[model samples]
Target: MHQDPTENIVEILLSKSTVKQKAYRNVCRAFKELEQEAQLLIDVISAKTTERDQDIKLSVEPVSDQEFHIRIAGDLLVFVLHTNIISLPEDYEYNKSNYVADQPLRKYLGQINVYNFMADSFEFNRLNDPGYLLARLLINSENYFIVEGERQIGFMFKSISAKPLDKVDLDILIKLIISQAADNDLVVPPFPNIRKITVREKLEKTQSLGAGNKIGFQMSYQNETKS
Candidate 1:
């Protein structure tokens, strides 16, 4: 009797890893919910602030399946939804009873990350623009989440187990993002010379743009003429 060489391949392809599938579902659901919540908040804030003489405009753009951009008061807050599994440190405080499973455990965490950058950074595609991680939603191996950084958010979920994100959780997450964005100190704009250099380079490269905006010499780049 000859064994089919493709038997193992077929079995492997058909094999279902229920735990991973569930984790992936959890991540996707949470991100989608968060996206919806953020949009609603933007609408509410825009409506309430529209009557002011000079209202700050907030814009949310979807960068990718796992990423979003929120512009508030000249700051760009990038919220990234990561689907990769993560693990908590052994030292992390949690009740083992919450994650009792038959199989040997592994730490798999998912993350919802927030980063702050200058509004013009994304506008000009500056890869090196200054930014920092304001917060993270960590989904532990047991499909529970614990938020890191941003005390307000951490405190919100401190008592709860890391479970799939729901409407309430999404709402709070959006609020936390807005809260961080409202704190102007979090985002540091690029140096004045940096902006000038970037604008100068763009003007030099694009012929359609007039030279009137050029700043004479590029302060960031050195010119060398070899003999």
Candidate 2:
């Protein structure tokens, strides 16, 4: 009853490939829905600002098939859908959860990364400025999703068994992301880090300054709320 090695390899490949395909499709669908939701949120915010005669710049721009950018005031949130599917590490918390344990195939997921950057970085063409990863959205073949992020974003959407991702969920997520980004303000770099700069650095202020919301601070997930 020994299985042929070639046949076994082919069978495993076929099964995993199918799972990857499904996960990719689900991520793509979620990305499209997110783009639409983001635009809707921007419109609502814009309307309110207009009502109050306030100038709050807000817009959503699709950068590519896999990426989009949402500008809310001084912060820019970039959403990028990864083309590849991935499996959770063995020790990852999701792997230990009953959701994935019940169906091991659920471990395979596609990812969409959310990054926060200072709008001035792109506006002023500061190529060396850094962008912080605010959250990662993981979607499985079944569209069951989880968000790994800072603060409320990390804890609020931990459940994978609740339901498939939807417009309402996206709206909530977009608001949380914008709130987190806006709450974290840019701070000056420590004296030691910027005290000793070369003459060349003085000439290239934009690149050498390395501006970021948490430029000289600890950016660990556990330390996010502390700041």
Candidate 3:
């Protein structure tokens, strides 16, 4: 008995969608694991480096279903996981020169983007600040991925065709990337025209009754001060 062409097409579509959904879930799992480990690493750094008055903080926040942020030191690293599966173009260098599993004509991938966020952009809730890509993950399988980004991260996996996320080496690589990101200072003095001065009143006690101390307030500008 011949199956209906329409039914066959429907089955194919459902199968493809199922594969993509599975891929998305896998990417999410990998991301969650990475987040947990990375957060722990940052906590260790904070415990080691924080001072009496100045505390070093590292935070992780989920901005959306597909996006989250890792705030390390004073900078923010945004991680965005794309839900849609994508295929490499035929002319792409990897497609042409790399070793593929040889199972399918088109290789589908789930993508994860790592972005740098200026402190003010995230803290102040400003949308105008532009972020640049710090790293990217092309996730084909739950455990296998290709990384592309800055030298600090991209160099770790340069020799391998694809890296396994579950490997111990990946944890080390992630730690290195986070440390490098923390060292990458993104904060700077705001523009002179846009900067503002904040004034706070300070109460001072009279010195030894005879020697009077002039009570004055403190005026602090961003990274600057004038009495």
Candidate 4:
């Protein structure tokens, strides 16, 4: 006997919806854990640095239900959780891994993105300043997680874990992110690029002048191509 098409559609919808709901819930729990861990870490750092340089500032600010900011001295790291649950593409390396092969639902993920920006950008209200994407954490319904990120964060966390990320794991991840952001120094823009600003720009958008760690790399690449 053939099954009814309507019933098959409903079954598929319900199954997928259930998986997505579970993934969303897992991500929300993970995010809350991350926020708590970050706050605790900040407190520890504050206590340790009490006698250190007075200029060094550290704080965590919750921006919203799905976002927060961690300010460490000259750097600002923004963490944003995507509201949607998504599945990795079939060709994605992680999707092909044995971890996901064992259970296809593990491929579904909720993403949390981390961005790095200069603290001065926000302080000076430089809306035009660029922020770099430092890392993204992907968590599945079972709480298994992985990170795709820059520098050490990339290589160190390329593989998906069999277990959920715990407090220790989160602490290490946060420390690494802070280290990466602190180490990435801002560079002066190329002289030619900044030498020809109009009077209006100098008066109005002076603070908006592009500033970032890798700001000049693209311009230099373009110059090289033209040459």
Clashes of each: 5, 0, 0, 0
lDDT of 4 by residue, 1-227 (tens): 97669988998798878888888998888888888888998888878887777668899999999999999988889999999998866777777776777777777899898888888889998777778788788888878787777567765675776567788878888888888887888887777887788889888777766654532121010001000
lDDT digits (tens) for residues 1-227 of candidate 3: 97669988998898777767766776787777777777776677667667553556667777777877877755677888787888766665445443444434225667787777665555655544556667777666444666665556655655223445673655775676676676665334446732443332111211111111111122111111111
Off by over 4 Å in 1: 1-16, 94-106, 140-143, 159-164, 186-227
Q: Can you write out model 1's per-residue Cα lDDT over 151-220, one digit (the tens) per residue?
A: 5655565533545456887798788867865763532234653344466667554432221121111111
lDDT of 2 by residue, 101-160 (tens): 777888899999988888888897777778888888889988878777767786677556
User: Candidate 2: lDDT over CA atoms?
Assistant: 0.80
Better of 1 and 4 by lDDT: 4
lDDT of 3 at 70: 79
**Relative to the unseen true structure, what is the C-alpha lDDT of residue 40 in candidate 2, on a scale of 0 to 100?**
89
Leading candidate by TM-score: 4
Listed in order, each prediction's TM-score against the native is 0.67, 0.86, 0.69, 0.88
All candidates: CA RMSD in angstroms? 12.4, 4.6, 14.1, 6.9
Give the true-structure RMSD of model 2: 4.6
Query: What is the lDDT for 204 in model 2?
Result: 74
Clashing pairs in 4: none
Better of 2 and 3 by lDDT: 2
Which residue ranges in model 3 land beyond 4 Å of their true spot? Answer: 1-15, 51-53, 159-163, 167-170, 185-227
Q: Order of candidates by TM-score, top first?
A: 4, 2, 3, 1
Q: After superposition, how far is residue 170 of candidate 1 from its true place, in Å?
A: 1.1
Which whole-number lDDT from 0 to 100 does residue 95 have in model 1? Answer: 27
